[model samples]
Target: MQSSYNFWLVGISFVVATLASYTALDLTGRIYLLASARLRHAWRLGGAAALGVGIWSMHFIAMLAFSLPIPLGYDFATTAYSLGLAIGASYLALHVATHEALTAPRLLAGGTLMGVGIAAMHYTGMAAMQMTPGIDYRPSWFAVSLVIAIGASTAALWLAHTLSNDDARNVLRKRLIAALVMGVAISGMHYAGMAAADFPVGALCGAAKGVNAEWLATSVILFTFAILIVTLMLSRFDARTTFLVGAVSNLNGQIVRLATLDTLTGLPNRATLTERIERAIHSSRRQRSLFAILFMDLDGFKTINDSLGHSVGDEVLSAFAQRLLLCVRSSDTVARLGGDEFVVLSENLGSREDAGALAQGVLDRMRSGMWTDSQPLQVMPSIGIALYPYDGDTVEILLKNADAAMYEAKRAGRSTYRFFERSMSEAATRTLQIQNALHDALAAGHFTLHFQPKFHGNGNSLAGAEALIRLHHPQLGTLTPLEFIPIAERSGQIVQIGYWVVRETCRQIRRWIEQGLPSMKVAVNLSPRQLLQPNLVATMLQIVTDAGVQCEQIMFEITETVAMHDAPRTIEMIREFQASGFEIAIDDFGTGYSSLAYLQRFRVKQLKIDRFFTNGLDEHGAEGSAIVSAIIALAHSLEMDVVAEGVETESQLDMLRSMMCDEMQGFLLGKPLSADDFSEMLRGRMLTT
Candidate 1:
């Protein structure tokens, strides 16, 4: 028996096979992305049915293209049974390809199993064509067909697994390419099976009346394509639905973030902070352990925001929030409580001192911090702490008290922390009183400078004088810096006060020069706020130039703490002062922890021993004398002069002289004097000279 092929119908079979393969690949991909097992299983079953029919139809079409000399027809029952085999094989293939973990062993076993199913379905379909002289299949050709079927099935399954989850357009192109390969392979298997069949010259087909081969192929082709096209349409709809579901999920996540996080810093917002604090309070009560709530406000943050724009301020706040996160344990919560305010909830603290230590750690970072580029801003926080079970048991009470303590810190002088005290609320009134009086005092000539004379440690020769700020209150008499400086600084009036001090220092020096007294430098204190002023160097230089006072007539004194706090910015400012021929001095030195490296980096000409260290120099050959002697030696080695302040005794003066200290200032030498008194003293000394 012999068969001739209609090449066109054969090509049509290949096209049907490619269509089925492509649909299987696409559907498999869609099914895997689904979150629900039921949805995946349903789509898998439907896809299997469509692909099975399509495959069966492709085989029938290929067989129709091969016309035997004798008539051929398929048994309805056997053919229906073959269809069931195709569907079952397809379901198994889909399941294996879509398995969650397609490891090596799993893929091998799954491919082999699907291969066997494909071989069974192919042989079973072949058996449906019953002939009077039953078809004899050649052993070699039969084995070859069986091998081709199994190999094709295995390769197709592997391709399905590999290509199904790829969602990109390139993946779709790859899938189309894969479909062509699998279609050719399946066609090869079918043709090889057809080649294996041997028919006698007189053989008669038993199922010749059952179904005409060409008609069956045509009918099934139409049916299979209909099923595949509809299945593809459904898959498209399902994919769209899945995409919408994913979008909704993302929207929900964003909504949750907006509710819980600060819009600016992405830190927990006030509500989230409150929730965490409440939870902590509950846990703390259960454990009978203490926690702490720290409330912090940026010192002078408003000045930066107003002067540099909110954009810069926002960046500073965000950076500070990140720094706060770094300062805490992962278990601790840091949150922003609106503008310039933040909160930290520290759990399992050992004592109030531990909380204080935590606050100090944050302060240290701020003290050493510069927040942006192109004129970096120095940010220091005034922190207030309220301990759990001591300050308050409830969240509201704790937060309230912490805020109150923060205000107290602002009063005590910003850039420091304060524990909640019963007396803090009352101190607020006094602080307010001082702040109110400061506005008029500068305008009314109540703000005055008192000059304290510095003498040579080795002799009574004058070295210089430090201009101390004093406010003459009509009702309360003269008040020192300790009484009102903090208030003025917080109110940002210190910048104006600083300018006034410079002008007055220059004026007084000019008067002394004109009065025939020898020219001497007078040191004036610079607040950090004043340093933050734009064009500070030029402004001070202009003031001095306008006063007819030489640059050498003024020295700027900065406390060692403030100078080293923001060292990079301070070093820059000092360079400008030095370049302008104004000498810089470190006031209250030895009080701050300035490393020798930093001290050398600064271009200061003098180091003013803080009163604390100066007071220590009472007895010679004592620890005080040794420390003073070491400091004087250290200053001299650095090519810098030392000024010992608060020298109130003859013994301290004598000790300072023995230590080779360069300058001394105290009541024993001369007290801080009014401008007139200092002038009279200067004139008398000039007369004596």
Candidate 2:
């Protein structure tokens, strides 16, 4: 018997097959991109069902297209069993195709299994016809048919692997082309298998409960299209959903970095540090161990910014942060608490000395120096360590104790580390009290200026006087600079207090000149904080101008340490002061390291020998006067005059005279007296040298 084909039905079969192939490619991409295992497994099962039905519909439809001399039908049970076989084959194919690594061996094995299943399903569907004298198979044609089916499955596997990427650009066009090739292969295998079978003449239908071919084809095609459409839509939706999830995760990471990191150094900021400290406390308590919170400040950082500008200062801070990271353990946390202050949280520390060693290591690194613009800069560190569960059990208390200890280190000449002591807390309390009292004193008009007369070294005439600040507290009584000066400097109260002294000195000078008293130059002590203040010369000039005193009538005295703190900046400020018609005096000389070069560069008018040398001068009369003589000669050689401080003894005065010092300021001739009392002495000539 001769068989014919329905071209329209055959075309529809190819369409269904192509759609299934494209859907298979889409589902592979969706499953591959999913990060959730459960989601991926769900898609895999659903995709298998969709692809299985599509392949089955195409096979059944193609079979229906083949007409014969006898009526065509399929047994219901056999038809259902063939559908199950098609589904099983599709499930295995998807599993192999969407695997992360579709190696050659894997593709070949999966292709063979799927090919065998398709062949069995076709043979099983053919058996659904249940003819009395079953159709016979031609061995050669059947072999060709099996070869075609296996080859089609392998090609489909390769195509699916190549094109199953998530990129949507031109994916549809590429997949459609790929699907056409795949559909043609699937159809070819089916038709070839059908051609291998020969129907005998007068074959009789055997199954009574078989389904009609038209109705089966129609139902399968419609069902297959619906599944394919929904699967493709779900694939697109899942891709977009996962991409959005990844974007949100990236955004959250950025936000966390911003909130917890320093803007300049990229180190953890105070908030992050606080959190870590709390965590460390919990962990250490559990382990019955200790950790340390080191509070550190860079000494003289203000001068660095002032002299080199903030840009270089920022570079220094960043480099300092990197160095801190290098010195600490990976488990430790180093954070910036703003400005030059840094806090290091070292956990699981074995002992207090271990923390001390860590701090000393940091100090040594800083001493080695850092470079910028091909020049090495000197930035020193002062660290204070507060041990957990000892210095403080809470974050606030620990930080407070550490800060107090740090200031003590700074006060102890800086460039060192200090452990927190119970006494430091008391000192901190007193400091707070003094700060409050200072505000009260400034507001309540309790501060006064006392004048100490300095006499010309060779004559009994008043040369100049040093203006000293005196504070008369309600309970502390009259207090000298030694009492509260350091507190003022540390609290930044010196800036304001220094201004008051400046203004009051100018006023006193004007008073002396107006009262027909000697209008000699008066020396005003300048603090390091005052020297670092911007526009200081201009500000003092304005104060002097307002007070109706010449700038020449006021002398500014800075210590040797202040001069050398930032030598370049100090020199520049001194020049500015001198240019504005003010003279600079190196007060308390020999108390700090003063190179000859820096001294010469100072261009000051005089050097005030410190009381240490002056008081010791007459002890041996010659050897005791050696440093005094050298300083006097150095001053003379530099065209600068010399003044002796704290010269109370007549022998000390005699030694200063022999050294040819330009001036002397001590109680030997006159002690510090109230403004009015000093005025009376100026008129009475009681301060005779």
Candidate 3:
């Protein structure tokens, strides 16, 4: 008799087989892409279990689909043994594939093992069946089925390796295609192996002892579908998470680039340039090689910015940066130190001539003129070069010397370059010494205040005095203001010095008040840096309050240059002082570019004529007389008084009095004297009056 096949059960088996194949292939893909070694091992184990269970379920379901003349049941121990075989074989196969590159030899070996394992499991499962007669097989058909299993296993491994190496576009689509192909191969092998088996009819066997075929098929279908759904979900989540991580990493890289690169010119910024210089220094010291730093400042760029607009200026700068990059070697670095300033670093230089040649090339290119928006604009470069181990060894020293050389180049001519000389280093050292000494002088009370007495223009009666700073160094001995004031200003020590002046002047005024002397307004000079201080008004007021002096008896004097530095802030500060009953005077009035409009706006009490006009007045010169007359008239019209400074002769005093100047201060009156001498002068003036 021939065996009857259940077409309905066969169709159900095929459907279950397809689902199991898809799940197993997807799990294998996930195992390949996991990053962490431990995580990858875990995924490999999970993938092996999934594929083994899926294959075993497909084989068992197909076994149930086969028809015989009697009822069928399974042997529990034999059935479990087949499942263990499938799991063990799958684990070994995945381990071999993932441990390293799946070369042809390794792929073939792994496939052979896996194929033989699956074929054995199928036959073992078949042997578990208990029916009227034992199972049989056709030799040729069995051989054909075994060949299909080995061929499908080899193809599946190759496909997995190809998918793992793929990095082209549409990667997800490619993975899905690979999954489908793998599913078909695995399912085809299972069906072919099932067709190889045979069962004879009218055969007597032992009574059924295990689960019934129908119930077992139902149970296997449910379990296999559940595993398929879970595996697919995990695969999708892993892919999405991997994509998100990659995106965040890419964004962080872009942010770092933005921080270190100039947005307008795409050159390294100041901070990045500093780091490069430090690295270059380290490398040069190790190699015993020389490097050069070139500091370049663009000439006439500011003119173009003012004539056209900042947008055009930005375009010009960008074009200049590109040309600079082309001029430097690949090993060199070019950086922008903001607004028309750039630095070029050349490392491992053989000689100074090489650096000079590079500088000349840059200067020639800059003088050639740059084109922006089809318009040619001319700009020149002033380059200063400092060599390593010769000019200076450190970054700060090299850059500072280079800057001094650049300024010297500018002073010599517009378009030129200069090499740092030993003299420049000496000058820089002297400047540093002066700064250090000034700090010590301020702390050691080596600074003194000299009060120059001012007198009423019409009468000999004394007006207030002007307080001047004089430094008495133990070694340098009695340094004047012109010698160290500029140094203090440059080193940002002026703010502290200015505050000291205010406090000392207030203390002197308080002493006079305590000594039963008449109240007199003493004027103190304010530097430009002092006026820019944010707490200027508050700090001055606190100092005066601490000295127990009335604000009305103290006058603050600022030069015309200071007033124009930041007009709005200057005016605001002046108004605050005036509101507190302190007088504001514009010192060195005629020397600066003080407009009549600002003069009217500022709530000042007096204008001090510079010594230039005062000295000329003694000669009765028509020009000097006219200017003095005009300034006095202007002051009167603005309700401000006038003072004439540097009056050293009787003629000058007479001329100032004729001009109706409110106060006069000069050697002819009473030269700047110590605080004690000033007090004696005031007492004598009172006695004579």
**Stretch of 10 with least lDDT, candidate 3:** 369-378
lDDT string for model 3 (557-621, tens) is: 99987787557777888889887778899999889888778789996999999998898775658
Q: Which segments of candidate 3 are over 4 A away from where they belong?
A: 1-291, 295-331, 334-343, 347-384, 388-400, 403-419, 440-442, 612-629, 648-655
lDDT of 1: 0.85
**What's the ranking of the predictions by lDDT, best on top?**
2, 1, 3
lDDT per residue as tens, model 1, 1-689:
77799998998999999998888888878877887899889988988999888888888788778778877777889888888878888888788888776777777776677666766777777777787777788899888877777788778878888887746668889989999998988888888888888887888878777755666777877888899899888888888888898899999999999999999999999999989989988988999998989999898787678557899999888878887887777878999999999999999988878899999989987677544443356778899999888888777888888888999898788999999986764565567677878989878999889999999878999988989989888876878899899779867899999999999888888888888877878999998788878699999999999999889888998999889877878899999999998999999988887889888889589998888877776543478777878888988889999999898988888778878889999999999999899889988997898
Every model's TM-score: 0.67, 0.68, 0.61
Give the whole-model CA lDDT for all candidates, comma-separated. 0.85, 0.87, 0.80
Clashing pairs in 1: none
Clashing residue pairs, backbone N/CA/C < 3 A, model 3: 132-203, 132-204, 132-205
Candidate 2, lDDT over the whole model: 0.87
TM-score of 1: 0.67
- Deviating ranges (above 4 Å) for candidate 1: 70-81, 102-113, 123-130, 162-164, 167-174, 204-223, 247-251, 254-270, 279-390, 400-522, 527-550, 561-576, 590-603, 613-644, 647-689
Clash counts per candidate, in order, are: 0, 0, 3
Residue-level lDDT of model 2, residues 1-689, one tens digit each, is: 78899988899999998998888888877787777788878888899888988888888888888888778778888988999999899888888888889999999999999998999889898898888799999998888878888888888888887877767678778888988998998888888889999999888667635566677677877887888898888888878888898889988988898799998999999999999999888888899899999999888787788678999999888888887887788988999999999999999989999999999988887677454435356677899999989998888899989999998899899999999999999988877777788877888998999999999999777898899999998976887888799888867889888999999988888888888778869999999888878878999999999998988989999999889877888899999999999999998899999889999999899899999888778666677788789989989999999999998898888878877888998888889999999899888874452
Measured with C-alpha atoms, the lDDT of residue 411 in candidate 1 is: 74
